[model samples]
Target: MSQHLLHTPLYDLHVNMGAKMVPFAGYEMPVQYALGVKKEHLHCRDAAGLFDVSHMGQLRLRGENAAKMLEMLVPVDVIDLPVGKQRYAFFTNEVGGIEDDLMVTNFGDHLFIVVNAACKTEDIAHLQAHLLADVELEVIEDRALLALQGPKAVEVLATLNPQVREMVFMDAARIELLGQECYVSRSGYTGEDGFEISVPNSHAVALATALIEDDNVEWIGLGARDSLRLECGLCLYGHDLDKTTTPVEASLLWGISKVRRTGGDRAGGFIGADVILTQMETKAVDRKRVGLMGQTKAPVREGSPLFDANNHQVGIVTSGTFGPSITMPVAMAYITTSCSQLDTVLFAEVRGKRLPMTVTKMPFVAQRYFRGE
Candidate 1:
């Protein structure tokens, strides 16, 4: 165990449950509990799986010019975000490269932002440097987050709080769960319909205990979490996205509002607008992140070289694993724009052997988002 690693509020509980502890993003987290990855993955797909995501950073921003200040850093239309709604967004540098991806939720008076753990400190520093003096930025370190994911997640969650059933995807609300005020959102990294609950740190253990007491819920670990998100085609920060990859090349243009894309009132004001706009007009991105499927059981790992039909080094695998839902090896890689088409044949250099692969559509598994009508 690394002494420098931080522990989540439920670290002791994970140890008590015989979780396989490992180091991830400077945290002492459980990669997989006793249930193992395969069982946990299946359980999440069929029933419900409880995940401890408290390592993520939670922050609050508020001021008279809060929305305006945030819009300067990101390309999203922050001013148009309605209260109780959440929008997926990215922080880009001046050159159109991604600084980090995050979720910004409008809370009527303030903006509640959830950022990646590894980039939290840097993200805060960047925001503070750019934000005007009137804008107030508060880091809420006294919170813990949990994710309940799967088809039966809503049913299990309704047992504790019935109001959450009315929340639609990307919608967040403050609800009372087990006598504690919690922020429950109908959103998750996995493709399954799930909810992420943010609770007071003091009540985290109690809430987790209550959820685990239910027979339908199982404690899932990071091992299965990675595979689940991979099957969903969701990008993992630092791996699939980084300071070098732009949102357009990552296929995340949907995050940028149409108003921002077109030269509307809010256009050309955010960071990297010139480069992003140029890319949009020319459609001249060099490489693209795509999904790959192999015919055999061989698994492709990160850093594997990708080759084109002419035996040229086109790209490299960023993330790869055997998806339990798809029952085969799945991978994500950055390939040349010309070879990024679906069903494009390619080869992955695994162990000095050329393994045949085909470019497949992303989200190997279908998404089940709950958009309440």
Candidate 2:
């Protein structure tokens, strides 16, 4: 076990539930409970699954210039983000390489940030160093995050706090559940209609316990979390995205708002603007990340080499797994821009053998995001 591992508020509850513990992103997390990965994945897809996501980093930025400071580090039009709405964006280096992918929710006077656990330390340092002196950066270390995901997630959550059903996807609101103030966002990584609830550490156990009491909700672990995100074609920071991959190569152009991309009134003053704007104008990205489906039963994995019909190494696999929904092995890889077209034939080097594969549209499994009616 790694000595630097941190434990979440629900760590003991997971161990008591017979979860398989593992170290992930410097945290002692449960990879799976007694039910295992496949079952947990299915449960979340077919029903509701509770996840402890406290390992993620949460920060609050406040001041008259918070939005301006954030715009300097990201490519999104933060100034235009409506209050009470959350937007997905990335932190970029000076060269346009992705430093980290994160979600920023505008709350009128302040902004709430949720970043990947692996990049928390660096993200905080970057913000503190670049933020204007007037802006206040506060790390919420005394909070815990929990996600309730699936088709029945809303049904389960509605029972606890009826107001949650009124929030639309990508929208957040402060609500009182069981007399505890919580920040509830209608978003998640599982590609399902879910809610991420942020609560004080002191009330974490009670909230989790209350949610778990619902017969429809089961405790899910990191193992299923990985499979769920994979089915949804979501990128895992360290594996799918890294300092070497730029936002353009990662197929995350949608994150850059049109106003920012075209240099609206704000103009292009953010980090990596030169390279990002150049890529946008020329569409000259070298490799593009795409989804791949294996023709055979073989399961491809990370570090797998990708080859074209000429047997030339074109790219490498970033993440892969046997998708429970598709009942086949699926993978994500970076391929030459010319060969990134859908239906392009390729091969994955699995266990010293080249397995037949083809480029496919992402989100191998359809998403079930619930937008409040």
Candidate 3:
């Protein structure tokens, strides 16, 4: 392990709980606890699992033109985003490729952004270079982000502060929980219902301890986090999504609001608008992202090539894992558009053998978001 690896606010708590620490994105993060990856993944599905996501970049963009300035970088309708609602967006390059994906929440006074850990440094610099001098960008360094996810997530969290019970999926708000004023969102990468809380660093350990003390909650780690997100068909940065892949090619066109597209009110102002919008109109992309499942128990992994019936390489796997929740080996890949259709048969080259894989609909399981009644 690198000696200069960074530690999260709950590092000592993870270590004392017998978590196996590993290096990721320059941080010594817990890969798994004594519960192991498979059990931890299942525990989250059945009960609740807490994650230390402090390594991710959290920033505040404050100014009257903040959202308008942010729209110049992402191909989403930022300016019109209603206050207290959160939206998913991705940064695009000049060539219509993804730079990084992020979440933007309209806080009335400012926009709160959360970016991927590995891309934070570059994302910060990108924002600094392009955003206006008046749009204040503040990197929040004194807070820790924690995600509490599962079927019982609401039940457990509501006990701490019943006000949270009113928040539905994608709702963002600032509330006082356990004596700490925290920024919280009823959202998570997992397909289950959950909440991501950003609390002051000084109170992080205390907050985590309070959550983990419940019999319904346990400490989860990165190893299980990957499997959980993969099973839900969520893309991981630098893997399923990258600078080489555009939102259209990655099946993320839905992320672009209709009003931002060619015929709508705020059309073609973002970076890569020409190419991405053309792709949207023509649908002539050579390759596309799709879901696949193996015929046997053998696990197919990333970088494995996919072949058609004629043995011609059509695509490559980007993210693969055995889904403990689904009890099957599933993966996502970039296959030729013609071969990316649902129910299309393909093969993944694992080791020296070509194993059969079928193109199936993503999110092998149902996404259970807690949308309020």
lDDT of each: 0.91, 0.91, 0.94
User: Compared with the true structure, what per-residue lDDT tens digits does model 2 show for residues 144-256?
Assistant: 99999998988888888898888888999887878888888999999999999999998999899999999888999988899899989999998999887888899998988
85-141: candidate 1 lDDT, tens digit per residue: 999989998789999999999988899999998999999998899888889999999
Worst 10-residue lDDT window, candidate 2? 259-268
Candidate number that wins on TM-score, 1 or 3: 3
Error of 3 at 53 (Å): 0.5
Off by over 4 Å in 2: none
Q: Tell me each candidate's TM-score.
A: 0.98, 0.98, 0.99
Of the candidates shown, which would achieve the greatest TM-score relative to the real structure? 3
Please give the lDDT score at residue 327 for candidate 1: 90
Which of candidates 1 and 3 reaches a greater lDDT?
3
Candidate 3 lDDT by residue in tens digits, 1-373: 7889999999999999999999999899999999999999999999999999999999999998898899999999899898999999999999999999999999999899999999999999999998887899999999999999999999999989998899999999998888999999999988999999999999999999999999999999999999999999899999999998999999999899888898876898899999999999999999999999889889899999999989999999999989899888999999999998889889999989999999999888788899977
Superposition TM-score, candidate 1 onto the true structure: 0.98
